[model samples]
Target: MGLAKQQEQKILYISPLSLGDVEFQERNLGLPVRAVNQEEFIERVFGHFKGHLCVFLKRADGTPSNTFYKHSEKERMYKYLQTTFGINTYVSYSTFYQKVKKHKSDILRTQSNIVHTYMLVQDLDYYKFGMTDAECLQKIGQMVAKGELICPTFIVSTGQGYQLIWLLEPFKNIAGYTNDLDWRRIQDHMYEQLKELNSDSVVKNPSAVTRLPGSRHNKTKNLVYGFLANEVTFTLQDFLWFYDIVPVADRSVKPKKLNKKKATVTTIVKNWNEYTLNKQREEDIFIFVNVQNERGKSYIGIRNWLALVLRFHALVSSDNDTEYAEKRVKELCEIMDMSETDEEEILRRSLPAETYYKQWIEDTWDRNKYLRGGLFYTNSRMLELMDAKEDYYIQWKMKTIKIKNAKYEAARKRFEKYGEEEADKHTWEAFQERRNEKLASDKADKLWQLEEALDRHPEWTNKQLMEHLGWSLRTIQNYKKKLHK
Candidate 1:
């Protein structure tokens, strides 16, 4: 647990939909030296007792540790018990092993047998509850026997009081949740109901951790064990008793006014863009990193996202034949500081798409805002699939071409109608005349080179020069004619 806390609660990090289950798993920790899978560990803990189980431990310092350590077959943890000022002291910083077991998100999402509610019994509050710890356990056993309240699957007698855990049945329908917002709704409803009954004390958040069975309480120094029955199971429907426990709708005296204290913590920033990609979002194959019209903002996280987008584009858009994809890829390669050859190999490699492509897209969308409509196409789903459906690509393409000469308008129209190849070829001259465009400098440089070559190699004919320069004879002849004029 300490290690997990250090890594921003890595073990506890779960899909919002799974938060309820994560909290439940936190509470029902296995009171043993070694941790095992959820089911086996639950079985071992609820099974018949063998020896003293170490539930909690503390270092020389008084700091509390959220973990339980040690399991042995002999000398029930009594050896660790100590008399402190006439009172037995066993553990301070004590915790049991807890693991969600399903490390992969996909597998864990499918699991439904999440603990819905947890019950905590303590001796410290017997005065308020008006029942001794033993009396409370007896009443609980009676309730179970009569089927009024569901029997707790596992019950532990902590030195201070008693801890009872009731497990809910598996709920298979866990997907398609709306922001994982409703998993704890039942817990809240139950809490309100308990408040009406004035026994809200028993209700604890599903994330709450109880004292590991077989461990001694730190202050009480008494051993903990299963109270009544060793094993049990109940349906989620069984929890309806909490509603009946209070039954607030009645003609009665006025309810007491409850005072509330609220604490506010301000956060400088928050990312509300967390999303799980559906099949459509998953198939969005290309992410074009474009500079927005506004000032460019840079961050290390966005830079890494840019690299990820480029890599995915090369992987999925590799088969696309459009000049649009090719041109965009070239620009992206330059921005990435990778050579065209490296880009080609990345495109040609017969490898699977990134395993975390969906995650990358979600993360990238949140971090960067330079994404433009040029990345997405306006028409043709097939073209969208071919070009990654970025909203900025066509918008950018339109904006860029219009800034050039009017002659390029027809080609832009042709691009919308006849696609990249015909459009680019038709717009070639206009593009060449526009200083802002790539073709203009390219044509100028070619003409300069031809003029230099004619002076240096006067003996070479136009055909030989054409062969060397990979230019058409017609183009060379035109250049020479222009030179003479």
Candidate 2:
């Protein structure tokens, strides 16, 4: 015998006319040209059909409802497909799939045994009031004949929450079995199922019921669950949808208030300028010395050079509001008796302020000695040249020289009085001698105290004797040895 083969049914998909275009055509206006192909037409019909069914049917329990208008998961999936295949294929697939998924739950629910009693009654009443009682009964009978009865079972165990089980008819006419079926009938059936399911209670017997793991409703729930478990990839559409839901806070986007206590560089410069302007003075020496003291240089010449550089810088910027950098340079050159060429050379050699100061100090120190007029010299001729308080200058010089001489003398005496090895040996000997002398004095005092303690407590043992005097065994023995000697 040969196996019987089922014939494939060929369904002709009619593309849906736009409501606006249909209205225009009814008024005898020219209609828009239809640009869709057979495949595109089929896809559009299927998508619309699926969407209609989905809207009518209730979303399966345990699956999250689509609260936001923009589908985040679908968008991400579409992008992934586009990257993998091609943009055209991704667009076609995404458009069709998105429409189908929208009404998938509704269609599946209509096929199940779970009929919504509320919608059924409502529809029956509508027909009765709109038409005749006979028409209402006739419609009701037709629905009952085509409808599948679903026995829903819910279970709750020790740990697990209530689980729902829906027992559906093996074969029945779903809401939209054929394209000829009325959409109103389909919606009524779906609503009826929802109402019935809501009224259903959990079943007690766990063994009697056979559990079908992956039903249409369960599969839909699982698909949604998996999608949510993965991170959601948001698009611009998603952001707009979010904005509609929750608005951003004003304070969050606002700039922070700045601290009032802080002072800027501009303020510091302004204050310094004002102070300088207030302290206007007559002709100052403006001595310009190149303070260069580094790499084997005299401290005296370096100090003088530093003084000159500092004075030159001060004089140039002394005007406060106005800068006299050029004038200061000319005055500095005149004071130093430097020619134009020399001045240019010096300016070129000096890089940054710190580098200039360093080089100047180093150069001055290298050529000079500690003369009586230098910074190191208390009674130097340079100090006499400057018109300042003689007493104050004298005092400062004396103090500085005294400190310097003391330090020098100390270092010199240490070297001359003792050789390296002898110095270390003498230091150690002195320390040891002082330690021994202190120890001897303590011992003598303790001996006298011990004698008095013994006289007061004659019955004391050696341990008790040592304990009372806070002496160790070795110390007590040594004291006894000294007594014997």
Candidate 3:
């Protein structure tokens, strides 16, 4: 019983902040406030943001190095905040870990890992400055009150120190790189401004994770808590008022055109043995293959995605000299566990190697058409089409695709209950279903017209089909194939 009492005391010591404490603080701090509790704090701060919100937890029983790390959508991370409240908790101020494992020790918490940053934080260790927590808080309040400092969005009292957070509209990385120069410049300026208060300049990077509010500071034996000091979310320009830095958001930087000549199916296949893929291209292929192999389910969209990947690969791989990619796709039908209809559908949807080569060049080489395909399959759209699971994305370097898929599934399920809610009837899925049905009807009508035209002129060339039906070369050819079969 004595041992049990000690264990109970330890648990309470770790998580001493109760709901009553939250209420008492809220009542005492008479202000137009927010974040009465930890959950409320998380929701108010990060509920709207997408991408990975990392949580770091260090337990009393564990060594300093034995910290727990988790990354998930901000909505999902709310649960983590509750589950890890007893431990010493910290959270990435910006959502980092773009393309990595859901949970791994090697998970990136570097500046490069920061996909988007929504806040700038200043760590004020009052003890280092020989000040009390109340004195530090009163000082910050006085600074804001006197217009010496802009009001922080929230001020977290970290038991011994304070963290002042200035929430901003998302400052996303440009072209996969953080706006390092401008970001750092702002950080430096902010630090300089608050250096009198002993603001730690070291924690100014985009990767910095702030100690979570409403968690126990094991050494200090005090509860960490925060309250909203300001409601307005600042933009990048707002900070520029204090810091004399140019706004990185307004830069009209175009992607640099590579010096290499445009790749053609003929040229690539002719020099297939000598041709080599760059690191980016190789990585793309590797990720695609890994995603397919791990999922092990060849849905229609999944198979078409496979065909698309192979179409690019075929331009550099040797086979039957011509149309090798298509042939290879056919040979793999049995291996892929695809039905005859599935194979035929995949083939029908698959564009030629030349077309794929053209699109690839446009995506990689042409600045205006960078990463744009005919279907405009954005990362999230492609993931949804593949019916990707949360685990499949770890190796693919994708961020927020799992969260997006979840949202899409939720929207779809909501759409299914159309009669229950008026809003559900107008969902994107419902609209897409309607659009697809109309498209199918239109295609059937067009096919009937083409069949009639073909019956009248049985020996009609593809040129004749184009002239008669007013269709493109590829469309007429596809219709011709359909008519013949």
Residue runs of model 3 more than 4 Å from their true location after superposition? 1-32, 60-80, 98-107, 174-178, 246-485
Please identify model 1 stretches exceeding 4 Å from their true place: 1-62, 67-124, 127-130, 145-147, 169-203, 228-230, 235-485
lDDT of 1 at 125: 35
Clashing residue pairs in candidate 3 (N, C-alpha, C atoms within 3 angstroms): 99-397, 214-224
TM-score (C-alpha) between model 2 and the true structure: 0.14
Question: Comparing candidate 2 with candidate 3, which one achieves the higher TM-score?
Answer: 3
**Per-candidate local distance difference test:** 0.36, 0.28, 0.56
Tens digits of lDDT, candidate 3, 156-205 = 87877878887776777544222454556677777887887798977667
| Highest-scoring model, lDDT | 3
Q: TM-score of model 1 relative to the true fold? A: 0.27
lDDT of 1 by residue, 178-210 (tens): 111222334455344333223434333333345
Report residue 195 deviation for candidate 1 (angstroms). Answer: 6.4
TM-score of each model, in listed order: 0.27, 0.14, 0.43
- The most accurate candidate by TM-score is 3
Q: Is candidate 1 or candidate 2 better by lDDT?
A: 1
- Among all windows of ten consecutive residues in candidate 1, which has the lowest summed lDDT? 245-254
